[model samples]
Target chain A: MKVRQVSIFLENRSGRLAGVLSEVAKAGVNIRALSLADTSDFGILRLIVDNVDAGVKALKDSGHTVSLTEVLAVEISDRPGGLAETLEALSAADLNVEYMYAFVCRVTEKAVVVFRFEDVDAALAALKAADISVLPANTVYAI
Target chain B: MFNPQAEAMPREELRKLQGERLRSLVARAYERVAFYRAKMDAQGVRPEDIRGIEDIVKLPFTEKSEFRDQYPFGMFAVPMSEIVRIHASSGTTGKPTVVGYTRADIDNWAECAARSLGCGGATAEDTVQVAYGYGLFTGGLGMHYGAEKLGAAALPMSAGNTEKQVMLMKDFGVTVLCCTPSYALQIAEVAEQMGEDVRSFPLKAGFFGAEPWTQGMREHIEERLPLKALDIYGLSEVAGPGVANECLEQDGLHVFEDHFYPEIIDPETGASLPDGEKGELVFTCLTKEGVPLIRYRTRDITLLMNSGPCACGRTSRKMARLMGRTDDMLIIRGINVFPSQVENVLVRIEGVHPQYLIIVDRKGNLDTIEIQVEVTEDLFSDEVKKLEALRDKIHYQIKAMLNVSAKITLVEPKTIERGLGKAKRVLDRRQRI
Candidate 1:
């Protein structure tokens, strides 16, 4: 599936976030999923927008520093055993999860998981080899 | 603003004045300067044949390269003992172009410079702090003599030592700051970090030049220092810093037509361009006796507009702000690129530091372009992959923007060499055939 994500470095200043968001919105990039990782001096704002290219362009044209990364979307269970099974499968595949976050699923009673891995294609192949549900970009966007 | 002499003299009267001076200067050059005499004689021309200003165009134009070819003191009209001051260019190769000035030349230079600086509304009561580099660079000495001639309290602060500059600016009540535009921003940044109140400082105006700057940067510097930013334009061989300056109205710079004659010529064709048409700027020193240059091509791309009375009521030709130089354009794989374009790209990228360089080299039979960009310390990461990816994305964006392939290399902040006087931003390695 599609896993294009935009990672932007933004100065910790007033109106900076609004400036980036306004440009992206003007470029018609629908907000898919978003999170901000903060550091002492600045913050790294990541986004999964409907148009990854447009979002990257918007952030760039508006003068915010941006980088693109491919992330894997893994379908995990909403219940306690779901995420544990997924992690165990990844660990068995010799894959390392750099960071991950929870996302809502389109299907009822299920959870969607997004993870940044050391090797994106390898991680996806590992999960698929184990019969773990690896969601596509369309499915993740819908979720 | 228009020059009062050129605008008000009426075309015929201006012609007569220029003719009279042209004949006198030509006759003097023929008699006193052996080089000019030889060149004119080789063409079978006499100074008497150049009777008027129209005849000036007929005479061969002297170039800066000719001075370099002849080396030190070959073009001086007067004897060696009469030359009171000697100035030189800082070029590394060949003999540096040397300029010699007589006591009278220095006086005229100071007067023209003072008149130009006077356009800024600086008075004798004002303390003028010279922030440009001193010694060999004519920018510092040229402005210094001008402010002194104006009877302004001159502080030879010279360059750098930010703390001392700010200290003198505060203690001496400096009213006018003189330096390159880039240095002005650097000083402002230092002042801001030190919690100095720039507005409270006595600086009412800044005479900034020796570098090309954009209108946005001009506004930024004006806002930072809370003073009127004035652009001063000139070169070391022609007469640095005081050749042209913007008036209070700030429409354009008024070339010192009384002392220096300006003509816009097509850089490629060498044909004279009409006023309001952008072209290369060329100047001839009519009054300068020390190292007088005739039709020295400055290669700076700008337009000359003679229409409309300026906010200031002078009659000189107003030169539009320089766009960029034709000579400074970088050729990449048969494509011409200007650093200004790269600057436009970098400045638009948030957190990309202003310190950047364009490296052009010959890779195989083709050319290669690498943009060395500085990463702000705040954005520095420990991970190489993350940084490498960022560099690749920048490379792609610049390639898209300029329509040329480029490599982006990020250097640690403050690693790029800082300039002492004129900043060197472009490094071209292709051997000229």
Candidate 2:
């Protein structure tokens, strides 16, 4: 129903994002999925890591500002109109998706899209009512 | 209450006394200091030309660079034998501005500092904690002597050692806290971290000076520590921390006009501006014998509050809190910008901390300013659009207020350097022509 996403603030300078990723890598934490939201001056690198505590500690030890966000990861069909169908259900429920990113699963014909909604619990209940498959925290980390 | 007679003197009588002091100061400067004599001769204005305080404009304005060029003891009116004490303030460039004090000068400074403390409601029963750094800097000793002269218990605690400072405040029952406003904030933070309620302490008033602080910061300190935060203004070149201070009314700082004559002048043309007009501040040491400066340009930007006498019954004129310094003003795209204006906008906005850094640079044909704002945990959002919206809001407000387009950069919390003495606000990287 919810996944813990690690968000690191990266200044728009060369090697800043690389430095952040390397900090987590030095702690032997595996990154499952990641998305970068950027502007001309700065960027926010959001990641779904296998070991949340280890990754956070590594980043913190390296003096990087890291934030933990609870986002919903839902499984949709890989075919076209899959996202549009899920979005239509969400629109019917009036759940607002603040921002979202996705990653494909090689094991199944489904794709996991991470969504940051205004209300996590409300979004979770809406997806459940719409019969959408919501991936659990453990499943997202393992995938 | 030390020296009530002088503090509350009638305006006309004060003016008369100021005129007499100015005449003596000019005569002494002309006879003793070669610098003053040469400057006066070049302007064709003799010592007799300045018969009253009204004729102060006849005196040549002394720039800060002149003090540095004179160096060690060239500006001293008295010989080294009569100079009992020496203090120097660091200049922006070159040699530090050195000042000497005779025994009378020290006593006068102490009297002024005592009067300043009295403005904040200090008395013989109060214990003052001087947390401003001691030695070389004038803040610590300046306030310490004032506390002593006021018949209050003086605590020379100098700066740093936060936990101990709080403990001493609790144990020794310090009634008055003296330090920069930022340092007071740091003390409050340390007290809270130690699980000690500073408001429960017996602090009645605080004298915060040496740097310009906003009204918001004053409220923050007062709310946290339960003390009347008063602004104390001074410069080592004239006399340290006791030059002027805000009385209990908290309207404006009452300048000790008899000791230091205050005047406002247009920084551009060096023409005298009337009271209540915003301009550069120039000070003339009226009775300073050791180092008598005649019409020394301070370069601080402020307006003289022309309102009637304060409610506290002091007839002395009050000066508005400093807006900014002339040197601190940055010209970007043919517009003058002050860091205080940027700070004014930042404090009014929600989710934005007052701590920020302004970086100015030249990009080819135009000047560029980049404002780096710290993103607090409460302001941080997972959505990129929300963060960008925050940046845009800051950009729009700055553009609307300052009329200068700025690049707003959101950085992580605590990334900008914070100086305990005076927080560094501006960084100019432009190539000097």
Candidate 3:
């Protein structure tokens, strides 16, 4: 299952991240999981929000370059080696994870991780074959 | 000391020679080039009226734009069969400003270049390593032919490959280096990095030009490399690198007045400024046969000093070091880069705003240009690969167009500071003369 992630381009300057977060908050969107990739010149802000379309619109209207990306959400047991175990399957399946971030679910003792893979379909197939609990867009958004 | 008779000619005799040359040049240009004919006709002036150097004011001023207006071969006074070589420099637009030379013209250029090199202490026994980029740019071939003309062995080491440059310099016993001032320093830094004692090289002198460099840079270069750093001045439109040179006196560059006559004019009102007063520098090509120019506005700001004879025995009027350009054209790494050219590239790419900021700085003896472009919503992608691709596209296009590599930084839409009226586009931080 694929989840839509809102990613905004941020310049590596003072208060740039805060400015984007304020724009998302003003749009009345709740952030699920977020990760920031940065270089010396600029940064890429990858965000998974409860409502992707509204968050993107607010950022774009505020003159930020925003785009939508499809990432996968996987549920795992909240344990010492939960991420390690999930990663071992992807490595064996030869699926490359471009990036990943995690968030603990309040409704259960499980953790939800958002992943961007080189190939989403291949990653989804591998996760299914591994019998991992792959959550859909609605289930992740509700959490 | 090369061509001593001409280089040390008295002012009275030199003026007579320049007057005769200018008279013939106008006649040839009026009779051949239709663009020159029209401009002269529009000014209600004819060739016969320009009988002497004093009558130069009667000729129409040829602007740089006229060169672009008369594209490929429109400005050449001679037929295509007579042209032996063609050189082009970057223009304000996509097309370059083209210049052509006949056999005699090439010979004259070689002689001028040789004289320039000789002024900087080059002799027939010296081996010159021409490090300026060859091709459409005139710096490399210009110096190469000059070294050959001077009877010195010419090493056509066209720019880059720093390791090879140093290796060849040591192994071949290069006595003279010819390139932009910044690049000469770059070579010295590279040599030091390679564990070579930079000052131990046999390089005696260097002719640095094609870009504006300060006296401080010259001193710095001399300190790093054991050589007499001399400033050579020229433009492709004005017959390339041998129009003027500093004759070891380091006072001012002596304009080869017998060939290319110099004048200082008010940049705003077009009135001639007196000697020693700073204004826009203009030149009238007195001996050019292919594309003879009459009072071509050079856009270079400098003054002519006619005070007595120089200690080096050259009697030609000397021009002070170039102050700056009257236009927004930035000379990065000896390449002419117009802001509008960058703007043209930006506008052509979809979703890129025409507004851009060009930041030019000197990074470790080399010029660095950084272009800050605002990223539009239509151009951005969530994936880092796609965003990087967009940045690479801009970088590649700019490099292709300007012939100079630029660091492109894509910023948030409103992050770039907008000016009140005309948004300032260029921020030059380089220490230039």
Best model number under DockQ: 3
lDDT of 1 at B160: 70
Instruction: Categorize the docking of model 1.
Output: incorrect
Better of 2 and 3 by DockQ: 3
Full candidate order by DockQ, most accurate first: 3, 2, 1
Candidate 1, chain B, TM-score (2 decimals)? 0.75
Tens digits of lDDT, candidate 3, B1-433: 9999999998899989998998899899999999989988999998899888999988888888878778888998888999999998765465677899999999999999999998987889999999998888889899989999999999999999989999999999899999999989989989999999979989899999988899899889999999999999998988889999998889999998898999999999899888999999999888999888889999999999967799999999999999998999888888888898899888887745645799999998999999998877677776677778888989999988887899999888876678998888999999866
Which numbered prediction scores highest in lDDT against the true structure?
A: 3
TM-scores for all predictions: 0.58, 0.62, 0.91
Off by over 4 Å in 3: A1-4, A22-29, A50-63, A68-100, A115-139
Docking class of 3: medium
Q: Report lDDT (CA) for all predictions.
A: 0.75, 0.88, 0.89
DockQ each:
0.04, 0.29, 0.63
Positional deviation of B124 in candidate 2, in angstroms?
Answer: 0.7
Residue B280 lDDT in model 1?
A: 89
lDDT of 2 by residue, B1-433 (tens): 5787898899999999999999999999999999999999999999888888999999999998898798989999888999999998643243779999999999999999999999999999999999987887789999999999999999999988989999999999889999987778888988999999888998999999876566877887898998999999998999899999999999889999999999999999999999999999999989999999888888889989999879998889999998877787675643447788888788777835557999998563246899999876556776778888888999999998886789998887667998999889999886432
Residue lDDT tens for model 3, A1-143: 69998888899989999999999999999998889988777889998889888898898888888888889999988878988889999999999888888888889868889999879999999999988889999888778
**Interface RMSD for every prediction, one decimal?**
7.0, 1.7, 1.3
Candidate 2 lDDT tens digits, A1-143 = 68999998887889988899899989999999999998887889999999999999998888777889999999999888999989999999998988899999877858989999889999999999999999989989999
DockQ score for candidate 1: 0.04
